[model samples]
Target: MRRVLLCLALFFASPLLANSKTLFLNGVYAATYGDIAWDKGDWRGSNFSAIRLKAGIQVVRIDFVSLTLGFQKVGFYSGMHKWSGDNDIGFDYRGPVLELHLFPDAPFGFSFAGATGTGYSYLTSASQYHYSSCEGCKIDAERSALKVGEFTAYVTYKISSQLEILAGAGTRSVKGEIDYDVDRGGVHSWEKGDVDSWKESNTMVLLGLRGSTL
Candidate 1:
């Protein structure tokens, strides 16, 4: 019946951030995906696509604790070769995050938070398999930059009075080191021997929306 009467008018709608903004510009955004429940961290149990662009607007709210400064990103190939879409094992992260929110004025607005961050981790490949043994050169398709750390937990829902409805789940622990020339026909090769020790800890899922103004 119309989704249970819009969940009974937001379950007796009223509190969508009851009162608290003393310098809190919470503007969040979210979209996420996950898999690799556990595969010795070699990820790609299909896809663990995470596109989370968080926001707490570097907050400060003293009543119920809100000290936020947000940002989280986990990436994977979609373009830039590997046949117009890449993935043999891909990873990337862009970070700067900090969060601490409890309560957040509840009313079907269950909020809980804990976040951590450390940036940059990009690796892309499958660039023509290095020309199948250097039959032809001039390929240059190896990209590298590593170092990642992330921790996450969030569940929010306010749905009104300036909107807030988010979904959550997380894991992005892509670690460093891959300094190899690997015959540069395609720039870098895994060959899985030892690229100075590679790593991956993927498992993510997220959904998002955030808006607030005082």
Candidate 2:
């Protein structure tokens, strides 16, 4: 029993001890702009904002090369207005990120990194539309969904040992189906079946800060 307990304790403690060797964490804020093209619909070009957080191991010499896993949240102000007009809709996405960075050893070092991930895209809005051929009669409804695939590439400047700033561009692609129903004044109307599979690819520019514990 004593030997078994010792083995179990060491097994759990091994990861914690290894994690103490080196830790890296960073955060970024950026603005993105580009075009979102749809296969079965129209294309939209717009600007968006994002915030990212990363944590991983240094794995190499300080500021040299490292692999990090992170998460980013993006907000789109008017990207969805083109779909449903005057609805005051909001669009956003959140996802897991994987990044690789290579930094040269210098004061004004220039670094390059690329990141990619998959996430969910959310849309919210309220609007009224004509129900069937009823005169002056309308129905109200809301819509939303989950999307996938986001990619980015960036160039960074190392200002100090623990801080860096970066600017980059990236794109997000999503395809999904949406369906809904509407009710008008005690009368129920169903808009059944798949409306249309929408495919969107948004391009954006990002400017953000990265701070770390080296």
Candidate 3:
């Protein structure tokens, strides 16, 4: 986690950092569990959520549509795929993120975003840290990645020439590896679990404020 944050710090310090108005210190929180539809409408419950953070600078602005480019750190959670009181594997994401915002002069707006180029991290969890040294115990090595994308519609209120606040709700997609899909294999087979991957399309609700160009 520290390494990923350090990478983003360097990314923001590069030439891409400009004086123009942009969004910074942004986050979205959502809980995704239970019998949700995806994976051919299959159910896979393991208590996960789409918790993300990102910061970016405006790259293009035409009328009410603006595009931003910057680094994003995705996922902040203690939830797990196949968890035990002892430990479970965790995931992390860091990559170039792109976002588009559409806002009129009124109090309504919308935004869409996607992120990629992230690698799966097994280092953040204590479970992986302790057991990784043991032979043939590492998980999620083949298809290791956590992917996130979102679409949100919001109502905004301008706070100043350089700031605005928004409240919104929509859906976001998150993909990650599963040690054992609780819905498919059930918890009984957690002992001899098989590897699997899943993509979740879940609800999103957020309150955020951003700095817009002056």
Candidate 4:
């Protein structure tokens, strides 16, 4: 009985005792194209540029499988031409990620990882429009909750113990509604608009720079 209890304890504690934690950062560029519909009509066929930053920490690793938690920020350029004065939108997705690595012991390795989490979307735009005789005097800003998902499959070449070069294709999708407020001639109005289900799936090349021991 004593030996069995000791074996059980060791088995439960092995992962914590032997696991190595890793930290990585990546920069991503993507092209986004999607369709959106509003109360007026179908606003179809729009494309824009996007930039994203991903930072993660691998908290648990058991052989070829690892679990990480990451925070990502993505910015989208102006796709709506009507609101084209210094306008951009951003989303934040932060949550746990899971990865599967093939050839974990080799210098050349491949891995696939995916993440989904809580997200927030923000948009800021300025335009000159006539709203009830308020010509050229309206400014709009929007904020909303977004649902975000990301997936990446990459091949890695380890240049050193702490650095790797990664080339991969990634897909990210963001969907949400925007609650916007407009200010025109000192009067305020509120309206709701949506991203109308936007998905950005593009090819990305990234560099994986690992941090020192944490």
Assess each prediction's global lDDT (C-alpha) against the native. Answer: 0.44, 0.44, 0.45, 0.45
Tell me the tens digit of each residue's lDDT in model 4 across 1-214: 3533453344333323432422234422111111011111111122334434444444555665544444443432221222222435544445555555555446777867787766665665334121344356554666556776768776766675434455566666556555556676778886543333343343333433322111
Indicate the worst ten consecutive residues by lDDT in candidate 3. Answer: 31-40
**Candidate with better TM-score, 1 vs 4:** 4
Q: Which lDDT tens digits does candidate 1 get at residues 87-191?
A: 554544545666655555563443444444444333345442323444344333333456666555666656665556656565656555543235455465533
Best by TM-score: 2
Candidate numbers, best lDDT first, in rank order: 3, 4, 1, 2
Cα deviation of 109, candidate 3, in Å:
4.2
- 50, model 4: CA deviation in Å? 5.5
Model 3: colliding residue pairs: none
Tens-place lDDT digits, model 2, residues 33-128: 111111112222323333343333333443466555544444432333343233343455555555665653344434333434443333333232
Q: What is the C-alpha local distance difference test score of candidate 1?
A: 0.44
Stretches of candidate 2 exceeding 4 Å from the true structure: 1-47, 50-63, 76-88, 104-142, 181-194
lDDT of 3 by residue, 41-128 (tens): 1112333333344566656667887776756554433322332233333555567766777772445566666656454634223232
